[model samples]
Target: MPRSVLVTGGTSGIGRAVAERFTADGAGVVITGRREHLVESVAKELGAVGVVCDAADPRAVEALAARFDTLDVLVNAAGGLGAAQPGPEAAELEAVLAHWRADLDGNLLSAVLTTTALKPVLAPGGTALAVGTIGSERRGGSYGAAKAALAAWYAMLSAELGPRGVTANVIAPGYIAGTGFFQGAMTDVREQALIAETHTKRAGTPRDIAETVFFLASAGARHITGQTIHVDGGAFTTR
Candidate 1:
């Protein structure tokens, strides 16, 4: 049988690209998203299973885990910047707190809850990967901080799962385009600025991150774990 793979937030963006790559490789793929219609549509497009799930909800994560018998790979790709907050009249401190909580729940707790619930059924020799962002290292604010915490958490997760022949890692991408991540706020000048920051002199693509994700889950990467791999085209070079 082909390897079974689950990718959360797989309706679009990097998650969808990852699912497509695996599907092309003939793996049995299951994808989850918060929107039912998009999940259904993407599932049909990719010929993979579709699940509607809110990964941040503990109960929902548990329910999702119960649907799987065993998983060969788990990709936690279900996170993004929280929705924009309301205007000034929305209670200053309350609005700020809610915004932070939403970001933390979406970007951090979602991965934590889903991974923990599925830990028992992760096949030996499998891999668990989370999608992180370059913002984690700098001026990302709450969204970046959530990803930073995710990287920290995954390091410990690798140690715990290593003996079971499982590996865990984070893939941090910088300025990937065509993901609608900017919510239509991207300007020509801003895009050029982002591109200039990269040694490649171009923005990254979903395929760029997808390819990295595929490699990390492959046999060649079995020895790598508890690490954050940057796929930013020298934008965030590590010394």
Candidate 2:
């Protein structure tokens, strides 16, 4: 039987690409997005089930778990940078705290809650892939910190889930272009700098991440659990 897969941020970019890849591989996929329209559109287009869910919300995550009959793979790709909270002009501490909290909710807790909810349904010998960022080591601020926390938690989670035959891994991506990741924040200098830092010297694409995820979820990679695979054209490693 084809495996049942879920990509939490399946409406766009890496999540969309990964969902497509799994669908093409003959798996049944369910993609979730906060937006019903986008989720429906992508689900219809890819021939996968679409569920509207907010991973940060415990109720939603539980509902998502209840919706699944059997889960073979769970890809937590719904994380992103939220608006930075305002801070005191004198301290700049509030903004930092707020941003970090949002990041925790968006990047860390979203996956944590969702995974906890779905842990029961996740089949033995399944894979759970969470999307992480290279910024945790780079110039990452609150965003990076939250992702760093996620990586840390996944280690323990992997140990706990291992005996159940469920593998939890992270895919740390570097400089993926056209993902709305830098939709409003991209600057000419930052763009040039990113390009110059890579060994491939080309921006990473969503498909690159999709392929890596595919490989990690494969039967051959069953032993590769609790690891973070970087798919950034050597940007995070060498740069």
Candidate 3:
């Protein structure tokens, strides 16, 4: 039987690419997106199952879990920068709290809730992959902070899942060009500077990350757990 894989936020960008890679590998892939129509369209186009779900929502995640009885891989790619929330200038404490909460909900909580809800369904020897960002390693604000927290949380998760034969890790990318990640925030000079920082002198592609995800889910990566694999072309290096 083909390995069953679940990719949340698989309708576009990196998530979509990861789903496609697994599908090509003959995995029984299921993709999820918050939007119904897009989920349906992408699923049909990719010849995989699609479910509409907000992975951050506990109830929705529970409902989503009911759709799959067993999963060999779970990719938590259902996170992105949401709308601009109240800035530091905002006076109301409630507004400030809500703003930060939204960031966590979108980026960190979504992965946590989804993983928690589906933890039981994850088969022995399965893998869990969470999408992260280089922003967390640098001057990450709210969104970055959330991604950083995600990486930290994964360490603990790995400790628990490792003995059970399930592996957990985070994939952080830097300045990927093909995705809508920049969201019109990137200018010509800024884009160039980002590219120049990389040893490869080019923005990373979704396929780059997709291939990494595919590798992590393979038997070769069984010894590699609780680690963050940066596919940023040497943009950020560790000594």
Q: What is the C-alpha RMSD of each candidate to the true structure, in Å?
A: 1.1, 2.1, 1.9
Q: Considering TM-score, which of the candidate structures 2 and 3 is the better prediction for this target? A: 3
Best candidate (score: lDDT)? 1
How high is each candidate's TM-score?
0.98, 0.94, 0.95
lDDT of candidate 1 over 1-239, digit per residue (tens): 89999999999999999999999999999999999999999999999999999999888888899999999999999999898576778888888888889889999999999999999999998999999999998889999999999999999999999999999999999999999788899999999989999999999999999999999999999999999999998889998
How high is the CA lDDT of each candidate model? 0.95, 0.89, 0.92
Candidate number with the higher TM-score (1 or 2) = 1
- Candidate 2 C-alpha lDDT tens digits along 1-239: 99999999999999999999999999999999999998898899999999999999988988889988779999999988876657457357766677778888989999999888888888997988899999888798878888988888888889989999989999999999889887588998998899888899999999999999999899899999888788888887742
Candidate 1: where are CA atoms >4 Å away? Answer: 84-88
Return the TM-score for candidate 1, rounded to 2 decimals.
0.98
Better of 1 and 3 by TM-score: 1
Candidate 2 or 1, higher lDDT? 1
Q: How close to the true structure is residue 116 of candidate 1, measured as C-alpha lDDT?
A: 97
lDDT of 3: 0.92
- Model 1 / residue 109 / CA error / Å: 0.2
